[model samples]
Target: MKHINLLLLLIVTTITIVLLWQGAQTREKESQLLEVISRHSKASDPSKSSDLTRNSAPGGAARPSAAAFEPDHFLTELNSLLDSAGTDSRTVQRAMRMFLFDNKGKLASASPKALKEACNKIEADWATDAKSFVWLELVSEIVKSDPAWAIRNIDRFLMTIAKEQPMEKMLHYLGKNGRLGDPAWSPEYAAELEKWFDTAEADGRLKGMDEEAAGMRFDLNISLGNLLGAVEQLTHLPEDSLSTRLEDLAASSSAPSGQRGLVEAVAAAVPATDFQDFTRALSQHAGFDSARELLARAELTAERHDLAAAGIAAADIGPQTAARADWLITTLRDKDAGAVTGFAAAWTQAAHKDTAAWLTSLPAGDARDAAVAGFAPAIARLDGATAAKWGLTLENPSLRTSVMDHVYREWHQQEPEAAAEYFGR
Candidate 1:
């Protein structure tokens, strides 16, 4: 009997110790949960509630009721928790998005004023510039459903911390949605955008950028193509003002060559009646190199071919002609060899006052021989006997043979009997 009582007492003592340890662990878990709830409640309240209102037990700590676990309350507490924990901005943003997704039904039913207030809260709490931009984007989306709100806030807070990306995205969105030209939103929005571009250009903000980057930043191709289109559609600005603005944009040397090319192409598209004045304006404002390049490009155009020929004929034999001589030669080579010979003869006559003297002064090589060959046909056509005499004077054997063959062909075709007697001699 004594052994049995001692064993039972030992078992009882062990059970008591285990129970006490379990109780302590349970209390510790409860304390941790309460602390979490307290922090959550504090973070959720803007004023930070000091009073710990909870269901208290006799001689025990306060405990939260099921009321605190309501869906809306839980989301608020979670948001507050995330914000106060100094979580990364993107992480917080994602978490908030998830919360919205989970409670999308509630959000859908929420009033506009409530939604705006919530967006304002998000804007105020988020730390990063990216978060602020996201808030604005959200606002834009929300206001799209409310046209009155959109009109009121379209220009307000339109800018983002990122230099141009947000505005560009917004503009693209507006254009894609056909809201940019909406009469209900007022034409002032488009005007505001134009003014912004003008201001940026004047401030040199768009200057000195690399070609590809500047093209993207300024929407160079799209803007230039649509410049007149905008004036016609928007009607907020005069055509003359827009034209002057385009001229200013084109003349900026800091802009890329492609931009200048677009300007030159537009000028070339002008009617013949206005072409002279257009070119004159370009020359006055776009500098000498640009003017020269514009003229060269214009000369290459199909419509200006005759004009190009006339201009080349009238052009003096100077540095300008020399500079353009290669292009002119290449252009004329495929069209008419006679014209090429005539141009060369003209250049020589102007420079040296004698084509034969210019030909003799040329260096002895294939280049000079080619020049002789090029001029031979024209010379033969003019006077075959004189051409044959000049052919014998050529130092290059190949050139002499080629010129003689050409002269004989012409002399034979023109006067075979005289050619037969001259050959027999």
Candidate 2:
């Protein structure tokens, strides 16, 4: 009987040890499960209670399961929790990004109307979250399939949102990738876009916009490359306001010389009869020096176009027939000295006298020297004796030498013996 009792005690001890081991194992598993639940709860809802530890399982189930951790369901629950009252903007945005990432494939495959509805829901839910850009993210996705709808709603979104962040984002997207010039643009859509710009400008939002946005607006609307569109926009602005804005735009250091394009576009848009007045205003607003440069470029472009169409030689084009007096002077100064001289001599006698007077009256500078050199060869070819007398009046020694060399070459070419005899003196 004692032996039997000993065996029974051994069996009882074995059973006790087994029960303890299993209990420890179950406790360890519970600890691990609680860790994961704690992490997920904190991530999805920071305000969740420490009492969750008593439940011993995640998702309020008897045990953790694969379904409890599915990313889509997890994100959906997290989003629902985040949408609750008192949730901060940072948390909402984080949750929104996660939701988007998890559902991106499904969203991409959805119909445009469905995609738009999802975006509207996000906007409605997060409208109070000042720092949230989830709506923009949604719009970006929506734009890939339905750009027109996205664009039409952008202004509406801007109107509903208090912050400039959304507007800036929309502008940035529009400016990037030539979205403004999208081939899908319709007349109604174009009008809507124009109206938006008008409102933005009137509200001073355009003025306060970032430099890139401002540049894109001007580039899309008022650039000379888009002459018709540019002119239409310009005509809508008051004259004084337009002049002021143009001056400011022209002063940008990034494109100082490029302002000439703006000037030319404006000039082309206006009636020819009003061009003088327009130029005068431009000179007053942009400064005389800048105005002159712009006008010169404009005249050069027009003349070149005219010449090309008329099949006229540039060399044969005379100052008298040119649109601007300065064009002729500039052309003469640019040509080779010999050509200039020949052209001056070949001019009508009245023109030759006018050219001579103009050259003499020029201030003593490289320009004056170039003009003197240009006229010397022609004068010598026409009458070497007279050119020799005029050579004495040259102030720069190098210029004087250049004039004499040209005169000698021309005179030699025309009458070698007489040129030799004249130089021999």
Candidate 3:
């Protein structure tokens, strides 16, 4: 009887532990389900909350699944919403956004044939102006999935543009839906797009739209991720319109690396005479890190390095600027200090008399302070007394001290007597 009791107790304990483990697993799954629902719900409608809760298992029924969020269920629901009379277009859009955000992975899984079929069905069912947006929205998502198909079926999108819509509106649709700026794009896709644009122009789709066509080409080349090709296209635009467009491009998020490609392209293409204005525009729009990146990547020929140095000298290097500028300085100093020194030397060379005169004429301000900080050490090594005198002119006292200390050390190493005499005064 005692042996029987011990066996029964062991069985009961084992059953209890199994039940507890299953209960913990259920709770964890429920938590995950709630999180996914909550996230998609917020994206769908900020005002509404998800009603999806963990249903109690009856007779050991299977757990809740995300089958409702899958494409088959969503497509059926989308069609139902579309068929329902008096359904606000916004409702459909919100559903689509939520579905796309949650199941964006579907882009990879959904076969191109399925996508093409969906696009065909949507085109066949084109019934009302209200439902027109559905075609474009799906096309945008499709472009994200299969860009080559999107390019081949480009006219399906172009035809949707109303004749009354302004060229800007058409451009916006192309930009947003074409996914032209998506970084995942390949060079071959870009070349194909370039050919398509050329064909469009030759076939009269872009007739009498030279300026707009050029703008689109610039954007496409930028999308190509080829800095030189994008820069080369800039020359095709009207001179008067180029600066405004370049500024817009510099400020645009449409480039692969955001503004970095446009920055590099423009830096390479700009005439040495206009670098200061270009740098300032970049500083105002993109920030100093872009300028540093441009400098870092430049081939640094005599003309190029001197022009870039002058531009960097004139632009804002304030505490309010990106902290990455300091990081860049420290990093460059650690890895390749000679490059910075060589750049400063080239800028101060007699061949760059105009650049030197411009620097000299600048009043004491952030530009001057930056210039002093950048060039003082090189000047110290070249002419110790002159560099020591130049470092004292900086407006930021801490910056002044820091630059002066560096300058003095170099100067002292070069000419200790001159450095001592200069500081003693």
Top of the candidates by lDDT: 3
**What lDDT score belongs to each candidate, Candidate 1 first?**
0.47, 0.51, 0.55
- Candidate RMSDs in Å, in order, are 23.5, 21.9, 17.8
**TM-scores vs. true structure, each candidate:** 0.29, 0.36, 0.43
Q: Rank the candidates by lDDT, best first.
A: 3, 2, 1
Candidate with top TM-score is 3
Candidate 1's C-alpha lDDT? 0.47
List where candidate 1 sits over 4 angstroms from the true fold. 1-78, 81-90, 96-116, 123-134, 142-192, 199-226, 229-425
lDDT of 1 by residue, 51-73 (tens): 43332222324333322223345
Winner on lDDT between 1 and 2 is 2
Residues 295-389 of candidate 2: C-alpha lDDT, one tens digit per residue: 54654344332221121111233453233323434543232223223234433232545556666666665445555665566677677766666
Backbone clash pairs in model 1 (N, Cα, C under 3 Å; residues 3+ apart or in different chains), count:
0
lDDT of 3 by residue, 352-400 (tens): 3333444576566554566556667766777887777777887788988
Residue 353 accuracy (lDDT) in model 2: 54
Backbone clash pairs in model 2 (N, Cα, C under 3 Å; residues 3+ apart or in different chains), count: 0
TM-score of 2: 0.36
